[model samples]
Target chain A: MAGSGSDDDAFVFPVRTHFHAMARRPGGIPREQAIEAAESHLHELHHEFKEWLDQELAEIAKILPQSADEVTSDDPWVEAAHARCQAVRDTAATMGFYLVTFAANNLCEAFDTIRSGIEYPLDAIDRDFKTLLLARQEADSADRTRLQELIRRMENPSAALPPAARRTPSK
Target chain B: MTRENLNLHGINFLVADANAYFCMISQSILRSFGATKIYEARNAMDVRRALVEQRIDFLLCDSMLPPSGGLELTRTIRWSANSEYRTIPILILTSDTRLNTIAMARDSGANMVVAKPVSVSGLYNRIAWVAFHPRSFVDSPTYFGPDRRFKIEGFPTGVGRRKGDKEFSVGEEDGPALAQDDIDSLLNLARKA
Candidate 1:
């Protein structure tokens, strides 16, 4: 424990320097060698990563509403989907799947906007979900870029529409 | 001032996350750093159990841990008057690196916020930094954790706002201000020390 006085009293506790001694002990592996070993382990886990990603996508699909009519502005499913996407985003990048991470991050943002009371387009959500699936299937960077551009447009449809055809009125 | 390679052997680490894959990945990274003992926790209950059973040297927690988030767990640990684990080094792992999110993690008593998907080098450096540079814990009325301020060059007005802060007078300048390169070199020296 850091301190031993009353809760109301402000105090400063000294640093614990034991870790320094532990880290500096002899016979430790070299930094580069340890990193190389870890990278090898991650490579071995790549197959498992695909299986994990598949399970995560399936869970997201199961939790999200099937149709726009089924979703309300404050639907709890939206939050659930957001959390699932966040998990995917956090893991995909570490597994060397940057495109999947990007698509998942996009969906996470859309859910965040929806949760904040904005009326996000359900079609955009569907497209992002599809993009995630496609990104997992396709490894081409050009295709990934194209899919990301499409999702960006879907995220903000009014940006693609002309001034006279905008959906929400500009302030 | 030379840095030594980190040896995490014999250190007990607790990795808490709702996602099992994330926990596995974190474990892999820690193992790469020579960690031999690691525990996994999926929720608050698991975390509490692990804290009670193990003498955890480090904690890597997901920002959105289930059934009451990681921040809540951190606050509970920090506010617990009698808990021996109150001052454990907590590193929050999350993909959300927005400014507000980082600020919230800091306010919740975490020592560091690591953005995901975590790279091997990034994780290694963060762990080494925390181990090498231990911060003094500050016990205040509204806060109980590592001191939020990283550096204390001086307050803006040569005074602090805290109740116990002391007022100091600025000394008259005796020489010309150092050049930018000179300042940078000085800081680099200090960091190396």
Candidate 2:
């Protein structure tokens, strides 16, 4: 009886209360205990996380255009690469790969801008790919911060750069 | 907001994502919360099959699910005329938290949109929120889904946009401003549930 109503009027379906009954059952573990267990499970899978991340990165690399001429917003490969970047963004942080998450997020934003008809420079995308590779190799916080700044510049080209960065001549 | 334990033992969950590792991560979190019957699907076709085969109580779907996307799948489920699962709660998980994407998910009838790189606490809180705060499904000409309006503190500009909306006078501000903790507690009350 949920969707049976006149199109001109709004019909309200009554709330389903069964979930409350099911979730409030007896013998539930403490909230902290549940979180700890889940975290432990994730930690146990840390070994596999590296392999998974590598595979995802390889897939993204494989799908990326080899040249600016090969890049097309409408291409299925572009979308595929974007989705893989999203997957890395979504899972990396949970496994303690915050730098990887950061780089993937930057790549996803770049992809979003490109999909919206903006003409993002190919060098920016290539730099993001390199940043991802560097993030995988470097775990130091200082190094991560430096990489993040590099991505920030790539994402916002017109923004004022640091004195040291500005002093360096354009490639 | 005091944390309350969740018992998801009897609640069946279907997690649909193209990434196998992501699916495994979701399953691990759900299992830790006491869920026993968790199903996995990698595409829209698999999702439909799971919905038909399993008595799914909840769905955690990736926004970029392959073939037909998650939003499309959600709309299909919402508009399905003969399916009991049409009204099941859906929570879309995504890394893209853009306003447009969130609006699309809402318009597609999802109960909630959870941002990804999901922390255990965040995931638990969202699941609890969806379970405890059930919204009334709206069946209108243009939309067939949960009422998109999450709050009814009278529309801004003191006017309603819809034809049937009732006109109401705006009341004067009352009482002192709430502290940040109070606001957080109110927003995260489901964590206590």
DockQ for all candidate structures vs. native: 0.33, 0.41
Give lDDT tens digits, candidate 1, residues A59-120: 98898677774344578688778888988887887766677887888898888788778887
CAPRI-style class, candidate 2 = acceptable
**What residue runs in model 2 are displaced by over 4 Å at the alpha carbon?**
A1-8, A69-76, A139-171, B1-3, B151-193
Best by DockQ: 2
- Which ten residues in a row are the worst by lDDT in model 2 chain B? B152-161
lDDT of 2 by residue, A1-171 (tens): 444442335566655745656876666777678889999998888778878888888888888877874344776677778888988887988876777788888898888888887767778888999889877765334455676675576567657566566555569
Quote the lDDT for B156 in model 1: 29
lDDT of 2 at A30: 71
Residue pairs in steric clash, candidate 2? none
Candidate 1 displacement at residue A65 in angstroms: 2.4
